[model samples]
Target: MLNIDGASKRGSTAGCGGLLRNSSGIGSGASLVTWISVMPTLQSSGESLIYGLTFAYDRGFKRIVLHVDSNVVVHTLQSDRDHSVVGWRFIQEIRRLLVMNWEVQICHSYRESNACVDALANLGCDHEPGMRVYEQYPTSLSSLLLADVMGITTPKVTSL
Candidate 1:
């Protein structure tokens, strides 16, 4: 299973991150985090999703279950036809990758339920523009990863 996420500050930097977990919700020790610099949040999200999928394919993963928090990105990917003008290239690339004889299922997840990758995305924003491939789990993500593996849910708070 893969949980992917993207982060951006409107007038600052942007980045994307993803985590590949096994059935037990433990990191497979293969993860991605990168800074894109100066892009809209939506673009960052789409790019991250694309990067995650491509990474999985390159690693010879034939059956993948992708979890993302952006509804727009998820909807665009699920459509058989593309109607995006801003992210046309990414949409096209994702389509091409999806047809590579793999069983890929993309699903929507709430942000709170996806804390590990979210933390990674924020970490990307603090770094220079580049990508990092990790073979071992980052120490920072240990607690959040544990929560996910234990099925712990974070309570949501809303402002009045």
Candidate 2:
């Protein structure tokens, strides 16, 4: 289980993607890749996380390790109080999801290390708004997925 990523372009579109991997670091054939209409990036990010958790729960996964690229979202999940009124409902939902008996851990991940899902998220931005579930890695994302599985790091340059 991994935290899903949501990408949005200038408020025009929002997309999200997530992958589930076994302890061996190989894909577990449970992945969610899709996009929705324009929405705030934070909202999309939160929604995607919830979506992933829900899927895990429905599938009877008792242990899950989720990774997200947004520190704000991670912090919110760890905090006892909600910070954003706009995201209050989502925050509550996340808290409820966490209350289950399942053992779940959520952590932050750098975008560079999460390139595979990032590319899938970008793919969502280019397509129509809907959800697409993948039992196995999609052919379109093979290169990036392979790199992630191989633990190959690509240079990441960020502008301040």
Candidate 3:
């Protein structure tokens, strides 16, 4: 499964991140994707999903479960609505990836449960230019990955 999140604050660089988890919920392969060009939150959200899916595809993953923390992205892609807007380009790319002879199950995840991705996104936001790839799980994510692997529960809080 791939869990993703995006971080964008005014006056801060925008970035997104994602991680891959095996069936047993062990995150072995993770990457920290950083976009030097700052963009809107919506765009960053799409970037995260697109990057994660592309990474999985490139790594030869046939079946993937994608977890995204943005409702707009999840709904836009799942609903199959295609609007030719600059902000929607990433959505189109995500759709393109979905049809590439692979089985993908995409869903919305609570933000609270996406601690690791959120951190990665923030790290990317503050990181210097260029991309940072992690073949193995980053040492920085040990605690978050442990909680995820151990099924440590967190409250599912949402906004109205």
Off by over 4 Å in 2: 27-42, 156-160
Runs of candidate 1 with Cα error greater than 4 angstroms are 27-42, 158-160
Candidate 3's C-alpha runs over 4 A off are 10-12, 27-42, 83-86, 158-160
Q: Which digits, one per residue and each the tens of the lDDT, describe model 3 over residues 1-160?
A: 7888878866546777787756655633343222222244546777777778887788888998888887877777878566557766777788899999899998888888888888788777776644566666557878987897777747886699
**Tens digit per residue, CA lDDT, model 2, 33-102:** 3222224454677677777788778777789988888899899899997787987888899889988989
Distance from true location, Cα of 104 in model 1, Å: 0.4
* Candidates, ranked, TM-score: 1, 2, 3
TM-score of each: 0.84, 0.84, 0.82
Question: Which residue pairs in candidate 2 have backbone atoms (N, alpha carbon, C) closer than 3 angstroms, thus clashing?
Answer: 3-67
The local lDDT score (0 to 100) that residue 28 gets in candidate 2 is: 41
Consecutive 10-residue window with the lowest summed lDDT within model 1:
29-38
lDDT of 1 by residue, 72-102 (tens): 8788889887775888988888888888989
Ranking by lDDT: 1, 2, 3
Query: Between which residue pairs do clashes occur in model 3?
Result: none
Which is better, 1 or 2, measured by lDDT? 1
| Decoy 3 TM-score against native | 0.82
Model 3 C-alpha lDDT versus the unseen true structure: 0.73
